[model samples]
Target: MKYKKLIFSSIGISLFCLVILLFFVLRGNFFKYTDINSMISEPKTNSLIVSGTWELSSITSLSDGSEVKSSEEKLYITENFVYFEKMGTTNPKFKFRQVNFKNYLLYNGVVTDKINIDTDDVIVVSIRDERNFYKEFIVLDKNKIATIYNKKYYIFEKKSDNVDKSIIEELSLDESSINPKKDISFLIGVKSIGTKDVDYETFLIRKNGDEKPTADKVEGLFVNNKNKFFLVNANENEVFVTNDYINNTNKISLGVKNATINFLSKNYISLESYNAETNKKNYSIYKIGELSDESQMSIKDIAGDKGEKAYFNDIRKLGYSSDNINLYDMKNFGVKRNNFSWVFKGILSNYSHDNFVSSEIDLDLIPNVDIFSNKSSKISKLRVKEKVPDVLDYFVSPDESVIVILTADDISMYEIKNQEIATLPIFTTSLKNRREVVTFQWTNAISSELTYTEFMKIKRSN
Candidate 1:
């Protein structure tokens, strides 16, 4: 009986040793394949950005270090001016007010501006409204600013410019800011800013001479030169585009279903169907200038099964390139020691005619982009350090050779030549309200083209 007991004890000791060995083996293997140090050590660039939980107010700093304060809920800045939105303590609606940071430093009196200027000076402001309304604006020039408030886009020139006696041809105040370039002026959010509520079934505000935008409900607007696009929210789905807004209504098989759209280029659009079974996600590329049915081509199953629901959590609008788009996605390879599920993932950007770059996040939380030159069958990984905790937003150059990653604290400009990454931490104030509502969070990763880079860049990074 003593010998039997000794044998049992020996068996238990062997089992314990095996478990310890296995744990170390797995950990060592993970590190061996993925270089964590080199990636994290890369340089970072900063921007004058704001940071905080639930950011409602913010301050901007001049290169000199003097800070400018303003309401955080709605912050807008131009070369010479800035504005904010505010609602009285007991008021039900919001109003607009201008701010002068310089005056705040001199004395605490109200700072209001009726004119726009062209300078580096930054200001803060708050306004009050009678109804639940939001306002956005674009500073046109000193003494003039274009803005959209209470569902109307208006060009607010200096009140002094009002030559009241002659024929008095007044510009409409029912619209928001307008992109005025000589003869071309692009308006956005038309129905939202118009006097009548039409629910804006299909709309596009562009230069009167150029092609109109193609979208069901353009909620967000972006423009570069003659190229203008809208983040169209149709039925719940989004379609990203500049022109060709009218063609989609009669082409796609969207039977009242909403979707999200990301404009890739004239020939391609990144689309995601939210009403799919099990939250299934897909990417479709449509031919430019062609109708939806004639131009659209979709890829069904992506990221396998795990990505069915997890895909929704990782969608963001990074940036677009002529041929290549840059975006990030999350991955769940395994868990870490702290019991926090290891979020091991990075960017999956497309470039150069089907050429792709798949990146992985190291343990130190930096991305090492893996270049897959399929045309040449060559694979290379470039390690880049991120100043931000995680890459939240990005803007890509036309050639996809450079990208600007916007993080909570800074914005870094990354160039794809010789693997160089520059960090730029911005000098912006941190507020409470804006940070909590509009910012990046976290999620999982998958391998599929069905997922648009837009979704991956915008989804809150956890």
Candidate 2:
């Protein structure tokens, strides 16, 4: 009888302890859930917020056979229409048709123009032929009703309204001009000229008569109106253009001792320097070089010293976004800066494509981590409903409010407001590597006329 009583007493104690522990656990989770909900419920000042994970396309296999998809897709958003290009697979003989996203939706596929997409007065660049590389580069400017193509030395413009009247002329190219064509990443726009062998001298031509021989390998060329030119390059380092052009000397030094003087644009440049004492990564930047000497300052040094503890870490990727260019100091745990304890460099706009905002981060920084943002203020990571690895690509809206994350297992769109979660889309894809998810978000201007203006203009192309 005594032994039975002792066992009952011990059991009751254990139960009480277990209940207390469970209560703490539940309380912690409840607080976290509440925090996320509060973050999502905040009001947004921006009109539309869009963001997402960019991924390569996937192949869907039916009982019949397998299909392939190409990865060269871009999103073009204008005041009237949103254009999307989805690349389809080529035939066995190496021929393929670029999948017109709009045509696919028109062919009874489950795709709909968003409520905000104006379709009536809409005109878009059509990829007539996908297999032809040269024609693929041709983007028809709908506003001018013309098709623009790239020639070796000039931009050929052809009116889409009247296809016969195409203006094919050399864009301000002379005997002294040498246009260096780069076929690598088709994201940047400016065409570079001058001595290829030389390190710091390149004749950056923005528009005709807007020619300037800039002496910094890192200073890129921006041509505004006619003669107005802006050089986006590092000015402080050895790479620089003299105040006066070299009138006497015809031949300049073709090579540079500093091999890292590669000018990406007037707003950005890449410099290479080495430190002897601490073996630190040495990079120099001259932001706003065209201005007075007081204005010209070293961007790298400013970003580097922001952290209280200047631990020497390798800067993998760095560039500006919006107004400020940021450099990511990679030291295992993603970007390390003393600025905000966990903040990173802001992304920059892609100068070549007005549609894209250019930003760079080393692949090593925050690899495999999901990045989410609420358009107005908050950006965070999403809790994975399921485990999946390998994200192919990501897409964020121009406003940076909503994000669609596509993985090997599923694709989802998350709505964020301020610093919180508002909604997760009900529609989820079970396919692996589901690519080409359209990213969209809500805006304050929810008028029907503004949303559906382009819808009225859809007509048969005669």
Candidate 3:
């Protein structure tokens, strides 16, 4: 009996020690689960929170009861603010708010409410209206979020934070061994002409070609590839085409006096001229090789007639959109004294053969570029805390992944997917007295290889 009692006591002591150890282990895990700092760390290191950018992948609409897939709409969430970009908007809609571990408050905006959090990592946002009260539940995970609203689900995916190592080689084109153009990577280099008569000195930098192609005298320039480029010289009243080499140039006379020419694409060029006989403005599209008129449509025909006269200022092909182009028109309606003007009007239009949509723009606000998807279109406006420098030229990538904005002193590249910006190593050589002209030629062959190095640089620089 004594031996059995001693063995039982030994077993009880062992069991007591195991319970103590198990309690501490479970306590440590509980602390980790409730730790707010670990949950909201940078997205690069942590994935279990909603702290970075989430792009709209698919959304179910309650109004029409239809499902729409949208890649252009984005939502950026930080500790301080929540910025949202909807389809067809020229600027990001922002709301000032504060976030905690389990709650958030919108201090200022059209809708002010306190949101709650649940144990399942679901965010519940409630809004009350005169007609109906609504609730939205956003289910969060490491890399995806499903936002439920009005009996619809809006899915978002977290953008990848990985940096592509190939960017260093792509940007460092001068040091590469392979042919730049042949391998699908090319860089745009612009040299300013010091002379007053010429405006642009543009050339393409490729590994297989000569050090630099001859710079052309062009008022407006567009490049399809290293072998083909189009130029418009209003002073000469001609549209020049160069193929195989820049020295081999062909000219086609437009036969319009005081006409402003813009290169639309390899196949089309837009001509804006004043008709003295009719005392009105005329716009026409001409084929590149034949210089034949393709379409002769007035501004009023496309955009409804306002009381004021409109002048075509610029035109560019919308990226990712199916043959859709944007036309910009400016009119001076108010009085001007020296440098000050009372009113200036600007109009932007999305134009295609079958459809036309137009909207007015404010001159006081910075202009935004429009991005269109199959289901919806979104406008991306520059929203910077500081004043932005004067933009000399800008180019959008073929995939609509990035945009490069060139100024007199520096070049800034913005990533649309991650909502990040980086400045490239290239600089401009234009002097103060000379006209500063910078243009970009985007090629699918080269842009597809760009990596996350540029995006990572932006974060490190900040």
Q: Which model scores highest in lDDT?
A: 3
Which regions of candidate 3 fall more than 4 Å away from where they truly are? Answer: 1-222, 225-232, 242-249, 275-281, 293-403, 408-418, 423-428, 431-439, 444-462
Clash tally, candidates in order: 84, 42, 4
lDDT for each of the candidates?
Answer: 0.29, 0.28, 0.38
| Model 3 Cα shift for residue 426 (angstroms) | 5.2
Better model by lDDT: candidate 1 vs candidate 3? 3
lDDT of 1 by residue, 1-462 (tens): 999999999999999999999999998777644643312221132221111112222232222222223222333332222233311112212223333323332232212242223443332223223332233333344454443332222344343422332211111111121211112221222122222222222211212222331111123332222122323333343333433333433323332245433322223333433334534333343443443634443211223333322333333323323233222122212111121111323233344565544332222221111110001101122222233445433433222233344344433344333234445321222211111011111111110111122322222220
Ranking by lDDT: 3, 1, 2
The better candidate by lDDT, 2 or 3, is 3
Colliding pairs, model 3: 88-377, 164-452, 184-445, 184-446
Candidate 2: which stretches are off by over 4 Å?
Answer: 1-237, 247-259, 288-462
Residue range 277-302, candidate 3, lDDT tens digits:
64545445444565633333334332
Which candidate number maximizes TM-score?
3
**Deviation (Å) of 137 in candidate 2:** 16
TM-score for candidate 3, please give it. 0.35
Candidate 2's residue-wise lDDT over 199-264, tens digit each? 222211111112221111122322121222222222223344322221212221212233344323
Candidate 2 whole-model C-alpha lDDT, 0 to 1 = 0.28
